[model samples]
Target: MSVNNIHEWDKGEYNITTDIKKIDRTAVHSYLTRSTWAKGIDFETVSYSIDNSLNFGLFHREEQIGFARLITDHATFAYLCDVYVLEEYQGRKLSNFLMSCIHEHPVFSKVRRLMLFTLTAPWLYAKYGYEPVNQQNYAWTILRKDMYL
Candidate 1:
């Protein structure tokens, strides 16, 4: 499924958009490079990843403030990663709205599974129906802490 069109969602004074052109690579790189999982990642690498993923950018006016991206084929599965709302934007329920837009996305409507790996904010994700992968189930990873650094 080709998701080439922009999808927009609004709430109060903010908006979340799937318009790749609206993503501020500088802001995304700046935030993720300091984040726990993507620490040490560079701008070029971040840009490359964004180019390949289905991205959702949370914006206030014209500024890019929060973001999440999904690596998926628009069918069977999706890996939700690079999810965050800048500290100043936290506590406004923006993350919740972001998650709602993601889960309700037409591209993900038939997706069989969605996965995310987070070391913090489990409570936030839990509210969107995300839970721990049962250890006994088919889950595995070769998680490199700083693969691109």
Candidate 2:
């Protein structure tokens, strides 16, 4: 789907926006480089992913403080990833605000399967109705643990 306009939600001085132009690539790359999940990921790859995905950028004043990328076709499925608030900004409920904006966004309404990979915060995702998958899953994954090495 073509992006016809920008989307934004605000809380006091903090806001989250869907305007890709407002995203700070350098800041995001800097955070992700030290992040456990996207560690060692290249800047080119980060830029490419942002360009292709439906991204939500979290901001304080004019600074990019957090980001989340949703890889979706806007109908059936979406993979939410790279979600975070800056270290100094955590515990301020900014992530909850970000997720609220994402939940209210139109793109996710028709999606049947929404999934995210996070080993750190189950409680956070649980508030959004995401639960742990039990049962013997037969799905296979081709993990490249050393791909960036």
Candidate 3:
């Protein structure tokens, strides 16, 4: 029961890692609570989610600055969610670097589908081959917007 699927990338002073141990739970929960999609989420729920998911964290030197998570089985499907870079950290292409690490992950080779929900950064995702769900018959969700509130 060891979850050790980690990948890391370094560019100058910025680094991205998938080692869940490196995640700063307090920083992540603070950000998600204020995010449009996850506002008012409690620390316990956020902690539980991180404990269960494959997480990617971005850091500057040693301080956590950004984060993302993949809810996946590591075999069939993956849902990318809760991705973000702090406002001060944006404009540095760290998001692109984050996506690169995710796309290059070996687990994806066996994954049949990847999905994500975003109300922002569509252009950034588009560059990595994500597109609007076929809208006709391919995409759907039973979205409970306030499920955690």
Error of 3 at 118 (Å): 0.9
Q: lDDT for every model?
A: 0.91, 0.89, 0.89
Provide the RMSD of all predictions against the true structure, rounded to 1 decimal: 2.3, 2.2, 2.5
Q: TM-score per candidate, in order?
A: 0.93, 0.94, 0.93
Model 2 gets an lDDT of 0.89
Score residue 50 of candidate 3 by CA lDDT. Answer: 96
Superposed on all Cα atoms, model 3 deviates from the true structure by an RMSD in Å of 2.5
- Give the distance in Å from residue 1's predicted Cα in candidate 3 to where it truly belongs: 21
Clashing pairs in 1: none
Q: What digit string (tens of lDDT, one per residue) describes model 1 on residues 1-149? A: 12457789989889899989889999999999899888889898999999999999999999999999999998899999999999998999899999999988887788899999898899999998899988785898887865857
**Model 2, 45-118: lDDT tens per residue?**
89999999999999999999999989999899999999989999999999899898888888878899898878
- Model 1 Cα shift for residue 25 (angstroms): 0.4
Model 3 per-residue lDDT tens digits across residues 1-149? 12355678888999888888899999999999999999999999999999999888999999999999999999999999999999998999999988988887777677999998899999999999998886686686798899767
Please report, as a residue range, the 10-residue window in candidate 2 with the lowest summed lDDT. 132-141
